[model samples]
Target chain A: MIDEKELVIALKSQNECERAFQILVNLYKERLYWHIRKIVLNHEDTDDILQNTFIKIYKNIHKFEEKSKLYTWMYRIATNESITFLNKKAKKKNITIEEVKNQLIENLESDIYFEGNQIQILFQKAINTLPQKQQLVFNMKYFEDHTYENLSEILETSVGGLKSSYHIAVKKITAYIKLNETI
Target chain B: MKRRENIDKFKVPTNYFDEFENHLLNKINEEVLPKNIGFKTPTGYFNKLDFNIKRKNNSRLKEGKLIPVVSKKTFMYAASIAAMVLLVFSVLKDATRVYTLEEIEISSIENFINEGNIQLKQHEISILFTDEILNNITSNQSRLSGNQLENYLLENINDLNALLPY
Candidate 1:
């Protein structure tokens, strides 16, 4: 793997900047996609939001101050893009964010890609029941296994607040799963 | 070792979620995005940098290959025609300004209006008539305010005074 610092240098040089950018894309694309996917739900929506996030990253690469790691910056963009996509959809469909999430889960359950994984589908559904902030915190911790410090940097929330949010999210999801376990 | 063996049952098997997660992961890994996928901008899946560099530089090469001679002549001809049209317009405008009869008449009318003193008799007549009408109205208003004729009429008559104009 190319050192990120070396890659940044190469990107700044204008020559072979495209090559460096390609490397950055390959390195972070799927990771960013999954992070975005967990937020948005629905594979197709994730794919669209993922592509848009990367395109935005590509266009705004010059603006990146490199004060934070590129991955963190990209993750922030992906999360925000996913949230924005959901908010727009919710507004257009005249539904609350929670309703939008429930609709997404319903689509996911019938989806060929999601129908087979009962556990993840249940887990995702339970997560969807959470408040948007709690859902984000839970995803970053449970699925991505990101540290609180890292999450705080990406989410721009205090680590303690994120931890409590994650705890509440887990408790709610766990109770939901337990309630549904018999079915 | 015993606990580890016992834990295998509780441990999620990689294949357990494979049917869904694997398919999802594979679909996600696919270069092509699924339909209804919003914002399908393929980021970093392929060599975009190389593609962009080639595209950006290709325009220069393409531009260079275009035969400049015929296009230049065509461009010059179009430009010359435009210039001639503009020149004709300006010359015609100047000629009209200097020699046009209508302009001469308009200029003379303007000069006469500016330099000569003229009395507006009709405006004075209208003003005087308006003043006379206003004075008559005010006098009638004063008489109506001072007299109780309207009240007396209202008390005596019913619908006739209401229907009739003073």
Candidate 2:
């Protein structure tokens, strides 16, 4: 992997900028794609959002202030795009956010991506039970193990507040899994 | 801002069974690997764009030779239109009403005094005129009282002398 700072320097150079952006796209495409997929729960939707994220990053790279890492900025864009996609989908389908999430969970149970995976399938259901904010925080922290500082930068939130959010998310998911197993 | 030094205590590890971890790791590995941009884009694609750029550049170089002939006729047409516009404006300039300084000042004052009914409140006008009259009357009354008080004191001076002779 190219050093991030070096990649940024290349992005600022007159001729190497496009090449640097291509490198960035190759670097983050998969992780970002799955992150968005987990939110939207569809491979095709993930593909669309992933492409759009890269395109937006390319167009707005000049506006990036470098106060945060490039990864954090890209993650923020992916999160917003995924959330926006889900919101628009919910509106168009005339469904509540809760109903949409429950439907996604049901679909995830039978999803090709969830094939032959009992624990991951259950865990995804548990995550679906969480509120939207908690679900996002839980997915990043629990699965991706992204640091609270990086999450804070992407979310524009305080690390202390995020820690609480993660804590609540974990508590809720644990309760959900236990309750589901009992039933 | 509280220092989040030991927030890992909040992380209750879900039973990430070995199979689950394997599945997750496989997904991560698949996702993090660099995509082959040229894998599907095929070779010689960029070369096509370069060829197009060169062709356009050559065309532009040829167009540079034809500018002088085109510019002379464009400039003549532009100048003729500009002259016609200036002549029309000059002919109409006298018909446009031109107010003198005194006329402009008087009209502006009248306009200011009668700006609009929206701003001209009856109570506000009455209060303003009342304030001016009251101020004038108050000053005059004070002067008249001062003169009367002086006359009364002077007329009573002989009576005081008769009552208390030295």
Provide the RMSD of all predictions against the true structure, rounded to 1 decimal: 23.0, 25.2
Chain A accuracy as TM-score for every candidate: 0.92, 0.90
TM-score of each: 0.57, 0.53
Q: Considering every candidate listed, which one attains the maximal TM-score?
A: 1
Which residue runs does candidate 1 get wrong by more than 4 Å?
A: A115-119, B1-80, B94-166
Write down the worst ten-residue block by lDDT for model 2 chain B. Answer: B33-42
Candidate 1: true contacts recovered, fraction = 0.00
DockQ (Cα-based) for each candidate: 0.02, 0.01
- Cα lDDT tens digits for candidate 1, A134-181: 888877776678999999988789976886676666667767777776
